[model samples]
Target: MHDEPLPPGQDGQESPGADQARSGTSLTDDLVALLEDGKTYLEAEAAYQKSRAGFVADKGKWGIVHGLAAFALVHIALIGLVVGVVIALSRFLTIWGATAAVTGVLLLGGYLFARSAIRHFKEAGASFGDDSP
Candidate 1:
């Protein structure tokens, strides 16, 4: 058979392995480089996670502030509603009678809401297989 030169790589460039062999990098050198790269990657990942947690914490603080503000405003609005109901009822009944009626109704509604909350809490606990009181 006629002797022929080996064909060049697809891009007509030396492969990466050829370059590494020419550079005389030993297996130990390659392993050390891999370890360094892994350490750098892990450090970068930790920094990224810390920054993400800080961002979430900042946003969560604002969310809690806004939620509390909304809750306060709603409670204020409910107070106004209670006062308005008391005033309207006073036109047909004595002021004391109107106040008593409103108080009783509010207490009843609160009791019902508390009962529902207790039931839901028990259901949630049961779902987790927690039977303790």
Candidate 2:
């Protein structure tokens, strides 16, 4: 009978795991490598999800901070407008007339600002619409 070289991992030849014999790729080696790669992939996916969640939470906090800052700025501007109108009206009108005119102007300004703020809130998607969260 013609003596042929025995296939790897058979007869006297050591198995793939013996001496870390990785000369040729074997089924056992491939399976082990595949499992290791899968484990690595899952670990990476978990880390990505954790990082994404933190990023979204940070963005929400920043949005809230910015909204509060804008609110304060708008109030400051309104106070300035009130002072300017009062000063300007005192130049021509009597005290009572100026007061009445300023009251009317203040009321109008308040209404306008309220309307504008509501519109802005809606535009910024702060208003709950038909789309449910």
* Model 1 deviation from native, Cα RMSD in Å: 5.9
lDDT per model vs. reference: 0.93, 0.86
Encode model 1's per-residue lDDT on 1-133: one tens digit a residue: 9887655566666776876677799889989999999999999999999999999999999999999999999999999999999999999999999999999999999999999999999998889895687
Residue 38 lDDT, candidate 2, scale 0-100: 100
Please give, for residues 35-75, the per-residue lDDT of candidate 2 as tens digits.
Answer: 99999999999999999999999999999999999999999
Taking all chains together, the TM-score of candidate 2 against the true structure is 0.49
For candidate 2, list the clashing residue pairs, or say none: none
Give candidate 1's whole-model lDDT: 0.93
- Give the distance in Å from residue 66's predicted Cα in candidate 2 to where it truly belongs: 3.8
